[model samples]
Target: MWRIVAAVVGLYRMVMDATRELFIRILMGILIFLGYVLLSLFIYAIMRRIMVPQKLHTLPVHLQYTPGCSDIQCPFPQAELILNGGKKLLSSGQYYKILLELEIPETNANQEVGVFMVNLTFHSTDGRYLSSSARPVMIRFKSFLLQILYTLFFAVPLLLGLWEQKQVIELVLFESYYEPYGDGALSALVTVQHHGVQLYSTQLSIEANFSGFTYYLYQWPISMSVIVIISIFVSLCTCTVLMWVSDVVRDYDEQRRAALQRRRMIQARTTGQAAQNGLGTQRRGRGRQQVGSNTALPPALEETTGSEISSEETSTVTGVEDLASEMGRGQSTPPPSITPTEGSVTSSDYSAGFNDVLSSLHTLSRELDGQEVGVANRNIRYRTGH
Candidate 1:
């Protein structure tokens, strides 16, 4: 089972690898095709430079001057010698047909004419059917140079755009974080048009439009470093404050726990001491009981005076009552109360003693309640059962 699983995994990996390779190859092929197209265009441009002349031949300058002529003159001569019997008259100005031959190697000085009226005609060398014209006007050699320069300038960026299209695509895909922009072919042509005037009713041949997207990237190390530094500083400060708070809270909790533990220990010790004292009292009581049992006392030879007996009884009861009062008020456990026997104190005396003890306990409870109220007013915290 393990072997089969391993084989399947290996096959999957191989397939994925092959697919990735194919994708990469496709991208590279696109790049190669783009390069080839650019190279071809560049070569074609170079060949055109060699094969086509920098200046085109000046077409034959055909013109007719009416007898009376002015810059704005339009002479209506009578038609006399017409081929179809339409009368015509000789109405002309100084007629000089200067064919502005835009010769390469060297330009003739007369090739430059200014402000003279001129007509244009496009025809074949065989003198076959073509356009006829009888108007003369200004011409300038600089116009030709201007046109050539403009055309060349426009052509450059266009070819460059074509050449770099693949690279541009790749850059856009992979380095999307960078901004890319260019005018491409259209921008080149617009730049060319800006250079010269069109005389022959120009028709633009190429149409190119390019669009690009912009992206942001870190340019300055200082700015990036500053942001990072600020972030780290803020984090460090935040962490420090948190840690300080934690430490303070931890210390406070520990101290509170320790205080509570100490209080409990003291309570425990006091309880144990109270238990021991109670045991000692019990032992003493047992001894006293033994002594009483062993000796037989003679019957009272003479009755004691009523006042003396009363006073004696009163003193004993008072002592017992004082002991009970102390036990009740102390908050800690006290020795158990000893009940007087039939021969001892009366019931009325015992009741009075118990009333005194209860009174004392009520007073202590009031005092504790007052202390609790005071603590609330002061916002003071103290352990209970202290």
Candidate 2:
């Protein structure tokens, strides 16, 4: 029983983990789908909004049956539209064409549409006459739906490729450049004319598209100022962010360079200071070595120095006594000189030669000691043995 329970628990856990993973995957897929759908809808809406051209339209007006409209007679049910309103503009700087649509929605049966005529007149913002276009819409078929479909497919393309629109859009009233900044008004007129004797007297029996068929005009859509402003704003923002980033990078580089330079300076100063300390320690050690060994001379040099000192002492004593005696007796005598010896050193042989000066001082002292002194005295001198 325990084994069965464990197996069931394991199975349950496994199933739960799989279910959780599946749920997560499903949720992610759903989110992605929703995001894609939303983006598509947004793009579609914007495209539709941008693709709608500046248009001039009016409420459909019934064209009263008559002998028909002629240029010599007044056209019936003229449609007028304002260019400055929320509707599509009727301004200049673009090509324009007029199309007439006839409909017989009240009729249950289909009837043939005969020849018709359309007139489009555009006026400037000051109500001044600008341009006019008149064309007899002579083409017709048994099927009104087919006619609408054909025009929808090829109307705008035909207008774009043809330069005949320029013939009607002559005279400048905000011309030379295209901008969504002008205002104007235009009128659409349509006339239903019979073709080669009216076969069917029932005009309402014709099946046609019932919408504003007579007022439709074609014009190319243009982008508004809002899109341009948004683009400029985005560009300025990007440039500002880039400039700020450049400044930050430059400042960082400068600070890093300064830190490296300071570090190098510190290293150089420490190195020089260490070198000076090393030299000072070496000089001090050398000075100590000189001090320690200076007093103890070699055996031969010690004996020589001692003999030189003893010989000088003896000479000084003898010289002083003789000088004293000579002065007392009113006679002068020369000072004694060092005899040549193997171990003795002479004044001329060494750097330290103080014996002569000491002897002179001694002689002077004896003369000053209340003795009549005569001036015939010489300094004791030393001679080294060859």
Candidate 3:
């Protein structure tokens, strides 16, 4: 049995889930229906109250026969009713002020009644109450003073059916807790008795009416409340959907931003790499140019060997010194004879001459081979055949 129950419950859940949208649509439809119903009720109530207003119902048999009703006379044993004001009907579910008057016949033909009873039974089948049938709300009392006495002594209304000597029933405020409509009953019964003998009794079908607050304010309370609750529910759902959409948008934006940032970084890195490559190419080209320059002679160098240039430079400097010295001495005596000899040639000159010769040889060797440049730069030393 438990397994069966579980299976049924699971099936029910599956069905509900499958038809969830249908159920929601049905609920929304019900809410709309209720709203429209309320609107119609509101319009009708306003129009009805204004157009053919309900004539306040009062008692006193005062109408050459009230328009929609027949008057009930005293000591009436048979119930009779005549109603004519059918053009207007009182609204349902409201309060009304009722006034009743009773006459004492001074004496009841050989029987004086010590007490009398009046009962007004009310019933209605209008409201959407749990009971589909007409529900009754009957109020009974002897008189206005006796009704108070009953209310005080019984603490609830003379439910014990106690009768006290009294005359007129005062104006009473009646609240129709149940909704009123056609085919409902408003009965009035009066009984006079003394010493266990009934002297007079009257029963009448009285149509009651009154003036007070309108029913549109509180009509179909349950339906209106349901509509309000549904409205709130729909608002909540809308808010939830909006929040979810916002979250989705926020996530998408974050992802797009991150992707854009990554793309920018990648582009920056690629640009930096390209710049570095270009610089390296420039440097390599410069290096090759430098190497090609070294492999050949330059225009700045003369075709005359570096050795010949050095010798010319030395001889010119020696001649300038000799000329300067002879100018300072006597014109007849030539400058002191200067000859190139082992002792006359200064060690500094010999060293310089050696360095110049080595430099010239280095340049010639490089014209042969571009390797071992410093090693090739050495003073020339000629040795005898060994």
Regions of model 3 farther than 4 Å from truth: 1-217, 291-386
Can you write out model 2's per-residue Cα lDDT over 142-167, one digit (the tens) per residue? 35686567557778775797422111
Clashing pairs in 2: 101-213
lDDT of 1 by residue, 282-371 (tens): 435323322233222211111122122234444543444454466566743422454656666445654444454355434433433444
| Segments of candidate 2 deviating more than 4 angstroms | 1-48, 51-77, 89-97, 102-117, 128-130, 137-181, 184-259, 278-349, 352-386
Residue 252 lDDT in candidate 1: 100
C-alpha lDDT of candidate 2 relative to the true structure: 0.43
Count backbone clashes in candidate 3.
8
The segments of candidate 1 whose C-alpha lies over 4 angstroms from its true place after superposition are 1-224, 291-386
| Candidate order by decreasing lDDT | 2, 3, 1
Best by TM-score: 2
Model 3 lDDT vs. the true structure?
A: 0.41
In candidate 3, position 383 carries an lDDT of 23
Over the stretch 1-386, how does candidate 3's per-residue lDDT look in tens digits? 99999999999999998799788999997987676666655655554455333435543322112233323443322222222234323444433433334422223332333443433333333322221111121223244575556557765334555643333324232333232455543332222212222322222212333333224314454664566455655665577689999999999999999999999999999987876665455435323332222122211222222222344443543443443344335332322334555535444554444344334434433432332222222222222110
TM-score each candidate: 0.24, 0.32, 0.26
> What is the overall TM-score of model 2 with all chains considered together?
0.32
lDDT of candidate 1 vs native?
A: 0.37
Model 1, residue 247: distance off in Å is 2.8
